[model samples]
Target chain A: MSLLEVKDLKVRVDEREILHGLSLSVNPGEVHAIMGPNGSGKSTLSHVIAGKPGYEVTGGQILFRGEDLLEMDPNERAAKGVFLAFQYPVEIPGVTTWNFLHAALNAQRKARGEDEISSPAFLKKVREVAKSLNIPQDMLKRGVNVGFSGGEKKRNEILQMALFEPAVCILDEMDSGLDIDALRIAADGVNALRSPDRAMVVITHYQRLLNYIVPDVVHVMSKGRVVKSGGKELALELEESGYAQFEDAA
Target chain B: MNVVVAKTGTGRALGDAFAVARDRLPGKGAISDLRRQAFEAYERMGLPHRRIEDWKYTDLRALMREVLPLAPQPDATALDRAAGTAKAQAIEGVRRLVLVDGVFAPDLSDLAGLQKGLTIRPLRDVLEAGDALSGQAFTADSSNPMIALNAALATDGVVIEVANGTVLTQPLQIVHIASAAAPGAIVTRSLLRLGRDAVATLVESYLAADGATAYQAHDALVVAIGDDARLDHVRLVEDATGAFNISSATVSLGAHAHFNTFGMTTGAHVSRYQLTVAFAGEGSKVETNGVNLINGKQHADTTLLLDHAVPHCDSREIFRAVVDDRAHSVFQGRIIVRPHAQKTDAKMMTRALLLSDEAEADNKPELEIFADDVTCGHGATTGALDENLLFYMRARGLPEKEAQALLIQAFVGEAIETIASDTLREVAIAAARRWLEARA
Candidate 1:
């Protein structure tokens, strides 16, 4: 059985149907890339799976470890080991990054009936992780994502992902507005999280990100549905011949 | 033919009380004459109502139907209760002066080891026979009825004078604690003067002991900064939930003087604070910041008047209010640049965050620039929490309540951070956090 399954998923936002009928399945340890043009419902899929509000699920079902995923709140779903790397990390002034990470960790722990991490131990863990990602200690002291450059914001998201260590990871437009060096750092962070029991979904409009973190399977999404699915070579083909053929075919 | 004017309930109560207590009060000659004039003015203008522009949002005539009886001088029991409350709010590394029931309580205060060139005297003592400075007239805003009321009834407060070219090593704290034993109306007044090239820090706190509710408090302050002098002032008020607070401050700056003041209001059923700051000489600067956190049907109002009469002066201000659960908050700030005040720079911003649909917030920022070469701007904003920021916090596993509390703290922290003292900043932050936790 697959670790995650989406069967005939349909969603509506603002009185308009964005996902008519979309279905996909992912097994453990597999990296799947969903590529599409703008307004093709790629982001809608990721947001709905993450339990973000304002998306009305009109039809279909989502199963995570055979449990209903839509029935949980955003925080509950997060405690159940689902994480999404946001495209634009929010700038929360007056909330230090260290406090944010600590609260998130402890809240998830409390939701799972686990004990909280001690201050000293939590401090040590955050320093180790931040150092591994080349995040300065001063950045941890500053407000979350406030006054951060493009590269720093993306790196912060990756830092969160590294700390959460969720079972299902979704990267939503992680490459947008990123310089080459920033993209490499973000991709390297994502690549380091791959595990045998974890499933990953990478959503993007271009194939440039796939060059660094190679995907096991590539799926073509158009008009809120998966139009085609093929091996890794499909990503290379789409990169060479722009998405015009796929858009026309769909 | 005759015309009859009926007095308001509070005005009648205060007038009758003053008529009976006049002869027994402190000062005799000059102070007695001044008090009578203030009382006559207050009688002419009964409790301010919605008709007054400055008192439009806060109508004391309706809110305060009748004034409580005047609080008697602090007895032994009242002094004991005041000691605990004053200690609870005291910060380390500061000289403390305590006032209980509008009377100075030397037993509960720290008076030994005074700083060099510092002279501390009770306002009552000064008013009796000491310095003519105590009887000096206030740079009064005759338009404010609260000022008149306070001047008529102020009982006792601290008066400190810093000598020329002297710098105090530590801050001085004036802790005003209303005794629960006598939960009644009280008025207090204080004064501070910074001589030329002198520097000082002052912290004023207003609080109440346990079960110290159903009381009314009116406080007034006068500040004078001489040439090249600098002063840091931090004021915090966390009164009981059933108390009413009305206070005012008048400040003037001399040549090249510097004045920075930050205030926080987090308690009381209803409160109105009026502040006026004027630049009297060239090359002076002033910065003022304030935050108000009110919930559960509480009402808080803050009014500021900035006068730039001299050239080459700067003024900056930022104020914020967090309203929740049917509470109402108001902020009125006005900046005036005189016709000849060239090279004046002034900017002011006021913001309010409404946590519930029924919560109300009114923010008005006005700028009057008579000089063409001056730069002046003002802005006002009222909004709820950002849905995007909330989602981002919840997505990271914080519960709805925690996320909201975090956002509210961040909103008010922007103004609290403007406080220059780390210890004072922490005091403000902790008070704000307690307000949030009570909501939860």
Candidate 2:
């Protein structure tokens, strides 16, 4: 079975439909890039898949490993290996990043019927990952994303994605606020997580991120639906000729 | 041409109770005159009602219509039960002084590792011996009816003195345990004096024995910090099962003295903690912070007054309360910068979080600055937990309840961080976690 199968997915927010009959299938070991304009429903699709509240799934079926995904809560979906890297990471004051990550990891482990990771082991792993991601060691001691620069917030999101090691990862406009250097570091972190049994969906408007994390399949999303699906060259083609044609097609 | 008025039922009952028990009250000597004067003042004012501005949010006359009679002295059996309760709440590496039913239980207290220059005595003994300090401790001429009542009916407490230039390494814990099975009232008054250049840490806790219920307590602590001295005071009150607690702390700081106070109230049917800090000397500093966790129709109030009576003194107040399940939380903070108290810097901030639909929070922060060169400000915020923050945590694999608890913990952590001691901060955080767990 495919890693994820979204068949005729329909979503509404605030009495208005956002994702209109959007359907896509992601297979294991494949990378799919969903490129679209700002309001083309790329974020809505990722949030819906991640089970965020405030989005009503009007009419659709989301199958993760052939099980209905909508039946689970956000945390359950996370334990089931679905991760969404937030576009605008929240700043939770007084909650240190170290404590937040430790709690999240233990909660996921508990949900999977596993014992908690020892403190030393968890600390060592966090140090290794944070160092590789170039996240300041002092950042772990500070409040989560509080007083962080825009680039730092994006990197923090990537660091979380690396720690969770989800089976299906969705990057929701993760490259929007990052600079060139931060973009490379974030892409490197994403590249390090690629595995044969894991699938990733990188959603963005600009094609600059696609240059680093190459996708096997690229789809142009317009008006809440996939208007075109092609190979890696499609991203470059769209970068050259903006999304105007795709918007016209919708 | 004045009209005669009828006394309130609570006021009349309290007057009758005082008249019946005044003869057998514990204090004598100079304290007797003070007590008589305090009772007269209380009689004139009566129980504070909604009409009183300071007690607007907390109307004791409406909530506590009548006061319970004084609790009888605890017997040996009751003291033994109190020992068990003290053991449960005792923190490691601290000297514990147990008080059962408003009387000090020295047998239950551990006074072995007594550092030199430290003296501890029972308030009853000091009052009977006619100590001059007792008069000063019992004399607080405030309009607070509750404090006046405490001065009038205080049965027993502790008198602690730290000699000049003495710095104690360990903290002193005063544990007040209510073991009374019957519904009654307990009044205790404590006095703490730190000599010049002396430093100390004091932890005062109030807890009810297991299965105990429906008891009222009026407790007061008068603290005097001498020149160049420092004191860290922590007050923890957790009395479950229909307990009503009214506590007051009157602190005076001398020249260059430092005082930091943190109060945590997790359990009580109706609890009001009043704190008054007076700067008696120049260049003194004080930081007062507290957290209140209330649920299940509970009512908790934290009223604070920072009196900058001297020049070049600083004060900061941070208070947070979380109200859930129809509970009501109140925070009233007033910072008064008196005239001629130049260069006084004072700031107060109060924040409250309401969990349930019926949960309510009332926050009033006021600043009265009479000096032209002082910087004084006050702010109050009342709202529910941010949904975005909660969803962010839940999306990161935390369950909904855990996410909410984490946010609430972070919210209250601002006030808890004011505690200077690492061990005490951990104890406070642990208590907060337990409150959150019970709430969940």
Instruction: Give the per-residue lDDT digits (tens) of candidate 1, residues B1-440.
Output: 44365776666777889987675567777678778888777777778889988899999978876666678877888888888888777788889988887888889888998878898988888888746876653446656778987888788888999999999988899888888555688888899999999999999888898878978888899999999999999988888888898999899999999999998888889898889998999999999999999988899999999999999999999899999999999999999999999999999998999999999999878888899898898898999999888888888888888889888888888888888888888888888888888888
CAPRI grade, predicted model 1: medium
lDDT of 2 by residue, B110-145 (tens): 877689999998898888888887787786855778
Q: Isolated chain A: TM-score per model?
A: 0.98, 0.98
Best by TM-score: 2
Off by over 4 Å in 1: A240-250, B1-4, B137-139, B181-183
List ranges where model 2 is wrong by over 4 Å.
Answer: B1-5
Query: Candidate 1: lDDT of B87?
Result: 78
lDDT of 1 by residue, A1-250 (tens): 8778999999999989999888899999999999999999999999899888899999999998889999998888888888888888899998999998998989999999999998899999889888888899999999999999988998898898888878898889999999899999888988888889888899988899999888999999988889889988999998898788877877
Per-model root-mean-square deviation over C-alphas: 2.3, 1.6
Question: Whose lDDT is greatest here?
Answer: 2
RMSD of 2: 1.6
- What's the TM-score of candidate 2 when only chain A is evaluated? 0.98
Residue range A1-250, candidate 2, lDDT tens digits: 9999999999999999999999999999999999999899999999999888899999989999999999999999998999998889999998999999999999999999999998999999999999998998999999999999988898898898889889999988878888999889889989998999999999998999999999999999999999999999999999999999999999
The Cα error of candidate 1 at residue A55, in Å, is 1.3
